[model samples]
Target: MAVRVSTDTFEAEVKNGGKAVIADFYSDSCVPCKRLSPVLAEIEEEQGDRVKLVKININFDGALAEKYGVMSVPTLIFFKDGEEISRLNGAVKKSEIVSEIDKI
Candidate 1:
């Protein structure tokens, strides 16, 4: 399962985490964002104990969205410590997301 993030927990949850964090920056109103949720869940399940999945509501805190340059929904940002390492915009296949995660 992924943790729902907001401006409140954004720093501690993603930036300070010891493990690599994959944050799915999205909004509820976006169709593609909704579509990618389940695939992310599958990634979470399949990679249990290996990585952490976090979902950020771009609508809740636009700063994070802007900071990451998330121009679209379903943007996936892979972070190592506090720095962003990789990013995928729009809804992507689960396999591709996993492959990106594997590279980290």
Candidate 2:
């Protein structure tokens, strides 16, 4: 399962973690966010050892969203070695996400 991150935990869980991180910025009422959840879960299940998945709820973590410059729901920010490497906005396919992960 993806870890739910808040501003308090974001740095430790994402930036300092010893794996590639996928920070999923989403809103509770977003339809596309709902659709993207399972796809992310599958990727997490398959790549648990290689990558780390974390979720930030835009409604609750608005500051964190703004800090990351997330302007939309379902924005996936890929991080490696404490820096963002790539981002995908919207409901992306599992294959597409995997391809991005592969780059890190």
Candidate 3:
């Protein structure tokens, strides 16, 4: 499962530090976000130590959403060494996500 984070811990946990992270910015009412959740979980399970998965609720963390310029839900951002390296927006397939992770 993806680790849920709030704005308070986002900078400490995900920004400019730690291992590679896949940050999912989403809203509770979004259908695409719901659909992508399982796919992210599967990626986390498969990658294990290679990466970390984080789920950020836009409604709960508006500041983070604004910081990332998340105009839409289900925005998947990839971070390496605390810097954003890549991103995937919307309900993407498992292969596509894996491809991005592989690049990192």
What local distance difference test score does each model get? Answer: 0.87, 0.94, 0.88
Mind giving the per-residue lDDT tens digits that candidate 1 earns over 1-104? 79988887988988764778899998889999999999989988988576789999988889988988888888899998878899999979988998998999
Best by TM-score: 2
Error of 2 at 48 (Å): 0.6
Once fitted onto the true fold, the runs of candidate 1 whose alpha carbons sit more than 4 angstroms away are: none
Residue 5 of model 3, lDDT score: 91
Better of 1 and 2 by lDDT: 2
TM-score of 3: 0.93
lDDT by residue for model 3 over 53-101, one digit each (tens)? 8889999899998998888989999999888999999999999999999
Ranking by lDDT: 2, 3, 1
- Model 1, backbone clash pairs (residues 3+ apart or across chains), number: 0
